[model samples]
Structure formats: C-alpha cells, structure tokens
Target chain A: MTHPAEIKALVFDVFGTIVDWRSGVARGAAAFLDRYAPALDPYAFADAWRAEYSPSMEEIRSGRRRYVRLDVLHRENLVRTLDRYGIVDVPDADIDALNLAWHRLDPWPDAVAALHRLKRRFIIAPLSNGNIRLMVDVAKRAGLPWDAILGAEVVRAYKPSPQVYSDTVEILSVAPAELCLVAAHNGDLAAARRLGLSTAFVLRPTEHGPGQTTDLQADDAWDFDVKDLNELADRLGCPD
Target chain B: MTHPAEIKALVFDVFGTIVDWRSGVARGAAAFLDRYAPALDPYAFADAWRAEYSPSMEEIRSGRRRYVRLDVLHRENLVRTLDRYGIVDVPDADIDALNLAWHRLDPWPDAVAALHRLKRRFIIAPLSNGNIRLMVDVAKRAGLPWDAILGAEVVRAYKPSPQVYSDTVEILSVAPAELCLVAAHNGDLAAARRLGLSTAFVLRPTEHGPGQTTDLQADDAWDFDVKDLNELADRLGCPD
Candidate 1:
C-alpha cells in the first residue's frame, strides 16, 4: 500500500498543537499576577517568555551550556526577563512557583477529546523537546493521556535532528514508516519526513496569540492536514 | 509513618511476577514436541531453556559481551538448546516464532485484577529489565494495562542500578518515598529500599515451577509484604 499501511503510532508536538501553550501561559501568568504580582503585564510577560524559548535551546545546542530542562530553562528565562523589566525582589519561592506555569499549560479545547478519539486506534505519545520529567509533569497536571512520553531527555538531542526521530523509532521499536509525526509547525514535519516518518499538520493559528505570523495554516502537502486534532483524528479514521 | 503514606505510583518488575513464563514455555514446548517430535522430553527442554536466563543476564552484567536485549538473548539461547536436543528440522521461521515465547507469556491470574485496582489509585508502570519495545509489546499482547512502560531502554541501564531508580523517579517527578517498587523477588525490593524507595514484596513462590530455589518468601522486612498483588493492593487500601 503506497499509503504506508503500517503506521501504528502517532507522536505529537505538545506546545502549540495539543495544548494552546501560549494562551495557557498568558492565562496562567494573568492569574498569578492577579493573585500576587498585581503590577505585572501578564500578556507581555507571556510573550517575552515564549520568545526566549529558542535562544535557551540554542544555548544548549551550541555548547554554551550543558543540558537543562524546560522547567529550569523557564525559571532562568523568567528571572532574566523579570530583571529586564525592572521587577527585582521576586521571592525565590514565587519564582519557583512561576516556573511551573509551563506545567499547568491548559490543553486546547479540542485536545483531550481528540486525543481520546485517537487513543482508540493508535499509540499516542508526545514527541517534543520537553524533557521527560517536564512532559510527564505536564501530562499529570493537565490530564494528557499519552501512551508514552518520548522527549529530548530520552535521546539528549533536540528536534529538527534526524537522530531524535530515529531514536524515537528505535525506542518504540516501530519502523519509521509505521509512525507519524503530528505537529502544527512545518519545520517539525519537514524534519520527521526526512527520517521516513509520516506527517500530519494540525493548524494552531493562535499559538503565538493574536497576530501570530507563522504556522497559521499547513505550509506543505503533509500526508494529512486538518483544522484541529479532532478533525485530524477523524481524517485518520480513528473511531470515537 | 512506618507505613508508606500516599503512594502515587507503583513500578513493577515484569518477568516472573506478572507472567508465568516457565509454565507457558513448558506448555508450548510440550505441545510443540507432541505435534512434531514425540521422542523429546519437553519438561527437560523447558528447564534447559530457562537455565539460560541467569547466565545471559550475568554475561551482560559482567561485561563479557554488549547489552543484548532479553528478546535477542532468548533467541540465541533457543537456537543452542534446540541444537543440543537435536531438533534441527524446525524451519528458521518457526524458530523465530518460538523465540517470541516471551511475548506470549500468560499473566498470573490475579495480575490484571489487582493492577486494575491499583491503577484506580496510583499511576502504574513496569520498571523492568526488558527493553521498552519488548515491554510495550508484552503489555499489549498480554493485555497488561500499564499507564506507561519504563524500562532499561530509557536509561540504557539495567535494574538494581541507582540510575534506573533515579531515572524513573525523576521522570515521574515524584520523591523517591512517594514511589513504591512492587516485585516478587526480595533482592529487587532491597535495592529499592536502599535507594529510599518504599518496597512491597508479592510472593510468587512458584515463579520457577518445582525447582524454584530463591525468593520463596519475603527474605527481609519491607514496607509491605503480601501473598499476591491483590493482597498487596488491599493492604495499600486500593479499593475493590
């Protein structure tokens, strides 16, 4: 079958696709600011934190620093971002609590329902740059029912690398063609396709919130594309 | 509290505790012999195959060879054992099929029911020497309802290693004391307890069938000792 009849597993990109991480962080920070840091601009703070994501990963990739998890990376970025905004005097405990904002990121409205549908047909897991500890914590805190949590920590390599995709297939013991990578980002699907994985694009136009300029729609002729995860599950014939 | 409080996760040792491998292999071999080679002593064949288990693990542990997964080791052992018994007429495909006996292991009668009970209260996973692919396949084939499968493949290290215990605890993001290792063998419990993990022993005295010489009963005081997994769950207040 030219359609790759053996695709038995689906690995998801968590931040934008499965969960509305940007908006979730904005909301979480808004709540935190309302409760404690009343003077902080929660939305601006959320954007600043999201913008630091890549630079922090680059620091690790470039050997400017050793490996650190998203939780630790978020804390470091949070402290620096707060300092940049002239908000010193944040308590260490509060900073620690704020770092967990990522853990509490809310799934998109259709995420849980869609995953529930997909779980009936395939092994679904998070294939992300998040560390295992971070992802597992997020799963527990957010009620994401992943069959397994596959992450950078498992292979100690970041995404867009062929090793990451190959390592996932090796660890899962499934052939490259027997798994599909589902993400909102074209770059992730491009990388996975290079390593022989099938691809599905689920649009998350507001991943960066209003005026999000990238990944607003499918950028390539991916194996499958849908408006959201629920639609993607349906397109794949995952029974409800 | 002397009794463990608020156990949030339960990690299991797979081999003898969950599945009756010895009896399954013996029965399969007896049936295979009855169908193909009436002259063979099927019980002796089963014991010979089982004898390879410890030496295979020892070989890898003592650095006589690289880390070969139990699946590969079983296949190699089966080839040698079948040769010794002069059962060479079996096709290579059949030999490959027979090597998968590990995957076809039958669960102990109480395993599913007790794990179902425990799952209602705790996140359940298998902390096994088996590789991730092996464990996942076994869980699927044997109808094991593990919330996740954590194996040596995750850390590339075998159990009783502090790395394995710490990797699991770190991934689950729980304190060592909040996680308990439940196993049929005493040594497994001793390792967990030494690493500050709560330990529960489920006696599987017949794991090796008649000639079972070790772990016949709880050899040391642990956090909990019960007759079987069901009893252990009851002791832990896992509701029916």
Candidate 2:
C-alpha cells in the first residue's frame, strides 16, 4: 500500500464514486414516473432499481449465467423493479430511455476538475462494473476524461470476483501494485487490495442518500483516504 | 453501404489511418541510429521493422499461436529485425524503449482536429491492431480525442478476422451498420464491409513515404472515399 510513486494508473469505481447515480436516477425517474406512476417515490424507485443490481450480477459472478453487458443486466433489473412497484403499460422506448438514466448521472462537483488534474499525471480510467458502452456514455455526457475504459465487461467478470480484479490489472499490463483502485466502497478496496493492488478510498457521506450507513468512510486503512476526488488529486501531488 | 445517418460511432484503424507510422518510426529509428548504425537507411529500417507485423499477427490469426499483445510481438520482432541488420550488444532497456516506438508515432496532421469534430457527432475510438496501452500512449501524446480504445487486444484477435470486426461492433453495442470504420487501407475496409459495417477510405498517399504505391487509391467502392480525415469529416457532415 506504500508504493505511491510506483502507481502509474488510477482506475476508478464509477457508480457512487465518480457519478451520483442515485440522484440522477431519481431525477430521471421523477420525469419518468410523472408520466406513469405519479404516486411512486422516485427516490424509492431509484433505490429499488439499484437494490436489484448486486443480486442480478451475483448470478453471473456465481457462474450460474454467462457474461452479459451491464446494459442488459440493467434492463432486466428495470423490468423486475417495475413489477415490484406494480407499474405497467410503460412503452418499450420509455423503458429503454429510463434505463439509460445511468448514462446521464452528474459527477460530484469536484470530480471532473480533480480528474482532469489527475489525468495530467497518471493514466485515468473507470474500473467499474459498467460495460464499455455504459462508461463511454457516462464519460461523454459528464465530460469525464478517461484514458480508456476497463471494467467487468472487458474481463467478463464483476467486482469482488477474483477475475474482475486480476483480469483488469492484466489488461493494463501493469504490476498489480502499480495500478490503484479508487472507490467509495471499502469492500471494493478490500477486494482490490487482496489482489495486490494499491487502494484509495473517497468518502461520500450520502452515496446511498442519508441515512445511508454503508461506505460512508474508509472502513479500513487505505493508501489515500480523502473527502473527495479533489483531495485525492491533491494527496497524490497533482497540480491544482 | 449508405447509412450515413445511422452511423453512431466512428472506429478508426490506427497505423496508417490515423498516424503516420512509417514516418514516425523512421524518425525514431533515425534518432536511435545516431547512436548506432548511421549507415543504415532509417526508412529501410522502418519498413524492415514493419515487415514482421503481418506474419507475427498471422501466427495468431491462423490460430497457430496464442494471443499476445502487439507490444510483445514488437519486442520479439525488434530482436529479429536487429539481427537482420546485424546490430547487437544493445542494452535490454534501450531495446525495450525502442520497441515502444509504436507508442510515440505522430498522428496525421488532420487526424486530431477532424477526430474532435467527429467526436461531437459520434463516439470515436481506435479499432486498431495495436494494443490498448499503445493506443492510449499515442492518444495521450498526440492529443487524439478518443471516446475509448477498442482493438485487437480488446477482442484478442487481429484485424480482418471476423471477430475483429464483429466483436468490435459488438463491443461498442452498436449495430454493425451503425459503426463506421474510417481507414486508409482498402483491405481493412473490405473486411469490415464484409461484416456489414460501414466503411470510409481516407487516402493517406504518402504513408510509405514518397514512393508509396499501395492504398494510394481506393481499391473498392466504399461508403465514403475521401482525401484525408478532414475530408472524411466533411463527407460525414461533421462541423468545422
């Protein structure tokens, strides 16, 4: 965890780390539900939709299903979440557009500038569970300056699975310790650290919206623990 | 062959299409030769080094060898090419750096600006034989505004192979016709076209220097045949 100077690239976790998915999804869902289930809580809808993310990926991670893109998984989860709310009769096109809510997420206020600062020194990319198309859409919409997109789809495995961590490092052709995984989730950091990668934790108090109890702080020691990406950039000696 | 409005992503073929590898490699070889074989023609040296590219890839394309990165192939070819030149006793570090000459190739003058204009209208990425790291290095140094990098290593297959075309289109999550391949080489276009991807032939007349004969003219009818990336951008109706 101490080889700071040796870190050549910093790969990020996207969902709650780079972009505020819950807020964006809620906003998108607000507009979406206004035309459908006006009484449904958009935030609850966002939470409900997100609630299905892990268990759906668990099927693929557990080898019960073959690898598929995140978009496919998201669409599947959206249907299931809709049924949970008893919402029906949504047009296919509307459902498709709503699924892309993930693509339009707004970055943390400090994320973009700090990412540009970090990009000036290190190779920066998303090491998210999102697929390449999803990463590209989010980067284009949010102006995230990524050198490349690397994630679960590239290696056909999701995070915390050993393959996701190892295959991503291998794809980069760098020493495991030389690629840092910057995430808001301690479990993600722990998995990456377990795989010989360096780790940095960015504290996001309301990643799941307050009273969110998880990943609000660094749960364990990390190479760099900071309040935001700006602090992470500053800690790594990137220019302001 | 005429789905102009449908093209959502413009994936490029990098070597002769985006960058002037012959000139850049010859230039790099010239600087390297100043320390060693000043008697050898840098252009000849460049061509000789490039001579191994197809055969090396053919090994993988034919399924006779396991998939390896272009960097690895380049390093192996470097030693062979050096022996062909009867040059030896070079330090491994220097050889390693020289092998990375692929990383430092200069983009054609019109490429970066044209790519920027194209990026505004579509997702732009490299669909090259070069590996991801090589694409990233070239883009960073040359200021190529790629939305992502997609190529041989990403699909673990070389160009003109079915997977190289189908898989890249699949990776972009675009319909084959919705992804346009802008390349200088006709055979590359031919292969892409065969797979139902749209193709544009950007003529790079002097890719092999003044005596360049091949690919100076479009070999077959393509979706768009133009003078350079600038013209290709114009043909695609991208803004100035």
Candidate 3:
C-alpha cells in the first residue's frame, strides 16, 4: 500500500461519492413531475435522466461532439428524457430549473462533516465531471467547503480522461502521486490510479439505489478503502 | 449607474483590493532576508519584486511567451529580484518559499468579515491573476471564503484582457451585466466595464504604501463607490 503521508490534496468524485444524487434527483424530479406530469414515476424518471449522463459524455470523450458544460448536457438530456417519458409541453423555465436539479444535490449523510475535517489536513475539491458553475452552485447549496473548484470544466474534458487528472495535478501544482482521488466509482479510481494518482475507494453501495451491483466494493487493491468520507478522514489522520 | 440589484456574482481583484499584499510580502521578505541577507531592506525587496509583476504578465499577454501559472512567474521574478538586491546563492528551497509569499498575503482589515457578509448575498470569488493554487493557498491561509477560484490561470490570460472577464462570465454562467467586478484599481474596473460587467471601485490608498498615488479614489463613474469591502457589502445590501 502507498503511504498516505504523500497525499496533500484529495479530489472527490461528486455525483454519487460525495452527494446522494440518486435520492436528490428523485426528489427534484418528483417535484417537477408533480407540477408538470403528475402521473409519472419520479424515481424512474430520475434514473432515466441519469442513465443518459455517461452516454452524453461519451460523445465528447470520443470526440464525436464538442465539449459543453455539464449543465448544457444535463439540459439536453432532460429534454430527451422528457420525450422518452412521453411528457411534453414543459415550459422552458421549468425545464431549466429541472436541469439545475443536478446542482442542488444533497450530500450523503457524512460527506460535508468529513470534508470539513479533511480540509484541515488536505486540499479538498471536486474532480468530477460537473462544470465550474454547477459545482459552485452545489458547493454553495450543499455546504461543500472546497478549497477551489477543479473538474471537467476547468480542464474542458470529462472525468476518466487523462487530461482531467493531469490538469488537476497541474492546477494544484502537485505531483500526481501526491494527490489522491477519492470516489465511490471504481472506474474513477481505476483511471486515477493508472495516471499515478493515489486512489481511495469509498463504498457507496446504494449510490445507484439499493440494487446497485457495481462499485459496491473496491474492485482494485486501492490505496485505501473506507465506508464513507468520515472514515477516510480518520484514516488520513485529520483532526476533528 | 448600473443597478447593483442585477449582480449575481462578485468577482474580486485580490492583491491590493482584498489582501494588503505590500505589507504581507514585505513581512514575508523580511523573515527570509533576516535568515539570508540580513542587511537588505525587505520592504524595498518586496516592492522591487512586485514591480516585475505587470511586465512579466505583459510578456504572456503579448504572446512573447506561452502561458505559465502566476506561481511560476513569481518564482522567476523572485530570483531576478534577489539577484538585483545582490542576495545570490540562496538555496532553491528557500527561494521557492519566498516565491510563495504571495500565497500567504494577509487580507485587508475588513476584507474577510465583509466577504462573509457579501457571500451571503452573492457568489464571491477571486478573479485575480494569481493561479488556482496560489488563490487556494491565499484563501485557506487568509480565511478568504470564495465561492470559486476564477482568474488568469483558468482563462490562461492576464487581467485587462478580454478573455479573463469573458471566460469568467462564461464560467459563472451569468450575463456580463449580472456579474460585478470589484477592485481598488481603476484600470481593472475600466477593462471590466468595457466588457459590460458592473463595476465597483474600492478605495485602497495605502496599497502601494503611504505615498501611493494611483487608485486613491474612483477615476471613472463606477456603478458603486465604496470606502472598503464593508461599505461595499452595505451598499450591495448584504447582511451584516
């Protein structure tokens, strides 16, 4: 195992690792559906909308489409999801607000407190696919105490891309090995580890809802494995 | 005057406006000089180093050199300043720390508290030439609570450049008019105003020392003229 002493910064995967986006989006979708398409199942609607996230990013990742902020992608996905659900005629204003639901995600129960503790010992920021505005809005609303906003927007590329991790390391002025990427997603950690960044696998078994099968456990021999951010903080010897 | 009510984000010029860099740099230089070059005047050393800032940036802005982070520029400037002061043979480590003096700058007396107040109402960030790492370090050390670090590094250009303000506006996802650029420098505000952003002129008469002549007061008809950040917050209707 790599020594934790070298880790000076901890960049998190935000969507599900730090925030309970599944539940947050479900709640937000429920409110929108109630106001627009009351008969729809908000949970299914949220899952469908979220299911489009990766594929949308894939287009940019594969260079098939130009890069746009996650907010823009989320808006496009929202429109497509609405059509898929056979719900139309939603006002542009309401649709805009619904798109911003990604910005209002709630933290997992232990995320905020743990982040505050970790911030005392490490530079903590999101290294997710979320754009600067979306991350800033989420940080402000969810009380995420980020030292700086770092992510896809800053690098102009989505996560799992070498550019994202490399750019974050360059921005932080830290060696890749001196930075740790914390995530509940195996793919994120895998990509980070391949780029020589330290990796911490955070278990968020219910991230994709109760039946979530993938990333329920650390797939690789990550540098650290912890149940939540708080445990990760404790293992890193952060002061309360 | 433009209405302050439309402003959604408040992007600041950090060095002379939020933090008293002159005093902070002088203090940091004194400590370093005391250990290495005891006979040197730290205040003069600080001024000499700062004097190189604009010219170094101009090189990048004019495309005489490719973009480099402010930290890198500061390091190069530090070595030249030390040589000019006849203080050579300093270890690379000490020189590196001295270059980071910019990151340890102390905020103006009312800056932090006023920022907290303004933060309750607006998205406050440092839109300075300082790179993300420098800004993050300064924010952490000085307790300046910023919503995001948006500046020269993020845009890969120095201030007074259209890319800096335009990219910042794009990142904040706010219309140019909906963002306010707050600074103690007339040139900065003038550049921002030309980009259609609301401008707030802050007074920092002693920024370049007691004899400081420029930017002593508002030069143009700014949208808001305030004595300090506290007054700026009050004029913007931020909570006490």
1 against 3, candidate with superior TM-score: 3
Estimate the overall C-alpha local distance difference test score of candidate 3.
Answer: 0.91
Rank the candidate models, highest DockQ first. 3, 2, 1
At residue B187, give the lDDT of candidate 3.
98
TM-score of chain B of each: 0.90, 0.98, 0.97
Q: Which sections of candidate 1 miss by over 4 Å?
A: A1-4, B26-47, B89-91
Per candidate, native contacts kept equal 0.38, 0.65, 0.65
Write one digit per residue (lDDT tens) for candidate 2, span A1-240: 565688999999999999999999999899889988999889999999999999999999999999998899999999999988888888899999999898889998888999999998998999999999989999999899999998887788898898888887877889999999999999999999999999999988888998898887788889889999998888888888
Per-residue error (Å), model 3, residue B238: 1.6
Candidate 1 per-residue lDDT over residues A56-84, each given as its tens digit: 88887776787766677788888888778
Q: Write the per-residue lDDT of candidate 1 for residues B1-240, one digit (tens) a residue.
A: 236456888999998888887877777677677766788776677789878877776776666777766777788889888888777788888887777667677889999889889877787888998876677666766677777778677776777767788888887778888999999989888888887888888888888777889998888888888888999888888888
What is residue A177's positional error in candidate 1, in angstroms?
1.2
What is the DockQ (computed on Cα atoms) for candidate 1?
0.49
Candidate 1 vs candidate 2: the DockQ winner is: 2
Worst 10 residues of 2 chain A by lDDT: A1-10
Worst 10 residues of 3 chain A by lDDT: A35-44
